[model samples]
Target: FMDNSKNMDIDYKKARTFLDAGLTYPTGLGLGLKIKVNGNYAVNLKFNGKADLNAIMNNPRNAHFAFQFVPSGSLELASTLAVDADVVESGVKVSANLHSSTGTDLTVKVLDGYGVDVKLGLPVKKQEILNFHSDVFSVIREKTGSEVETPVKFNVKREDHGGCFDQLNTLTGLTVCGEVSVPLDGFKVLSPAYGPSKASLRIEKEDESLTAYHFRAFYDNKQPDKLSLEVLLDTPNSKTDRKFLLTAKGSMKPQKQLLIVMESPLTVPTTFEAVVIDTELEQAIAAKLTSDTAAYFIKIGAHISGDINRRKYEPILEYKFPETAALSDKGWIGRKGVKGGRQQQQSAVGISGAIYVEKNPGTAYRQYELQSVTLNTPNIKVTVDGTITIDANLIATDLKASYEKDTLTLNSKIQKLGERKYIARVDILPSKYP
Candidate 1:
């Protein structure tokens, strides 16, 4: 029954009716009807599925919410909201593709034999800001029911550029605890080739009492060389919280010298100390020369000070030799086929020097000046002063060595053989006196 009047009222005490009808109404349904009938009424209604009751009540505009329903004992609901996520468990993996607005794609994978609790969500519309809570790690641990045992790999790619990283925004509030092992192959493109098989990174950021981030990386390999790096940022207890320290232990030869380049001025104390193989005095003065047997007892210390913009370096270097017993008994430094008796034992050597480097804007090389470099031994004392220039991986030195009543001019050029390998050729000329 249809009514065209503005107001209609129908009253029924007991009625049973089964009706199936489709209705198309205006925004406000411009009519009012009162129903007082009640009893087993089965009515199936279908709308355009774009009608919204809230929109029609607030504003009789074109707003809509399409609605269609069938009366049934069991009903199922479905949604089309897209989500990006990944999970790894018990050798089974599940992941979803990520959508990036900037055309850059990122893939994060947890390597095999490991598990991770990764949660991600994106809004229906793009937003600029992303915030993370301080307890994110804890939340992840709680969800996974255990700590992560392997590293989470990150691969970022850009269609327009070719590099390890491109157009990536900075992420904040990220705290990682426990140990995470990262493969060295992931950073093969970086400079100063990494020789370590793996790098283990550890960070302590869960402690609320500490305001700084304590991070450390241990680079380990089967070779004799080993490295450990530590960094502390925003530490409150120290005078300078931004501290970086690197310590290495390995053989000498190619790895004899440590080079540190700073892009900005450092306000904290930065030091480098290494325990390396001891090349005899001859090998120490000339790189190409080597002893038959080498010992790992030379202690080198260097305090680096310089900034790249200024192009000037002034570092203090000091070398401490091992005890005479170890040097002589162990044959750490000796001439070939020379049998040393008790009276022919060798004496310990001590060296202390400073190096100054200045780069000219017009020149393609930098000059290192050795100032007041003294080498003292029980047999002889020598003073060295020289200017060394390095260009295209070639190191050339013009220096004067004075000992006793003789003054010698030393000219040497060191050539690189391979990775962490070098050979120095020296030509020593002496001036004759009556």
Candidate 2:
């Protein structure tokens, strides 16, 4: 018997750590600091970290409003600043990061009106190294092809970590001090998310070092489907030393594809545990890549057999080495034509493979064999070279075709490819002589 109990699960530890901490809703922490800069610009400061209270914000022009830099192992200061001007339609936004041990970090971003943006880095300066990035997609609207009538729908975009685990809410727009009616020098100041009575930044001795840890996702608010848990633990006697973070995520897609994936953020040595059970197929795969070249995968698939009483099972164990696994290569690239050039024509090549098997209730089983290799582009033609098996006979084919006018025109040998398989099967089937 397999010792499944001995498995090292980070999810178990993460759940206990998060639930014990509890959730805190975003509060409009009363009146903060507001200052006027120039004829067209103004600044607002909000300090929400565990730091000393300062009502008078002097020289509050973006980063200038921050508390004087403090030495390590002292007061924990969590603060942010914002600036606005009539120029560029909106002024640039700058944030003042205050840490308990280290000085402060300043990150500036422009307001491009992209609707959504995700900024990486913890509220505490020390906890920036183990910055967690999770895979959670928010709703985004965009028109696909010109032919399509409406915009494309929202989807859970799967991005293979090129790099963040916690989804950072895009940098917030300008927030004016609510309580006091302090007007900007020139441009109109936009309203904050809360009313004037609320404080912009509430100062408490116990500030959250985890910064942006708690997150909730709901399709219709019945219940949450994704859970992101992260814990940032910093050791004492540290100024230059960076803090560490432990992160793990769990997601359930009950409506689509019936998927449950639990991930442990291991950027250097990648690993994942996932189970996919849907109407058409069922598979459970666990993969771990300890090093660049050494990787292992264990998978099990379930299939219903012809006989209802019997079930078929497929157990697969695969190991990938540095030599055999050939990674995909960068394909050919060249300018097709330029305005004053002689219709510069260039062609390049690449390689790809696929294995697809399909079956219809009681019909012949058809499996799409992997094509030897081909390159596909808008103005390029290619050949299909792959052997397919239909019930009993095996067909070898080399078919060529060109695609134009949004149609694929087959122009090759033997009528030219699939007919050979049907003709061969006809000779074997019994003929009716009248």
lDDT of 1 at 399: 93
On residues 222-291, what C-alpha lDDT tens digit does candidate 1 reach at each position? Answer: 4544332222223234333233444444344455543221111242333333323333211122111112
lDDT of 2 at 68: 24
Candidate 2: where are CA atoms >4 Å away? 1-223, 235-239, 254-273, 278-280, 290-294, 321-434
| lDDT, residue 433, candidate 1 | 46
Report how far residue 90 has shifted in candidate 2, in Å.
88
Report every candidate's CA lDDT.
0.36, 0.28
User: Best by lDDT, which number?
Assistant: 1
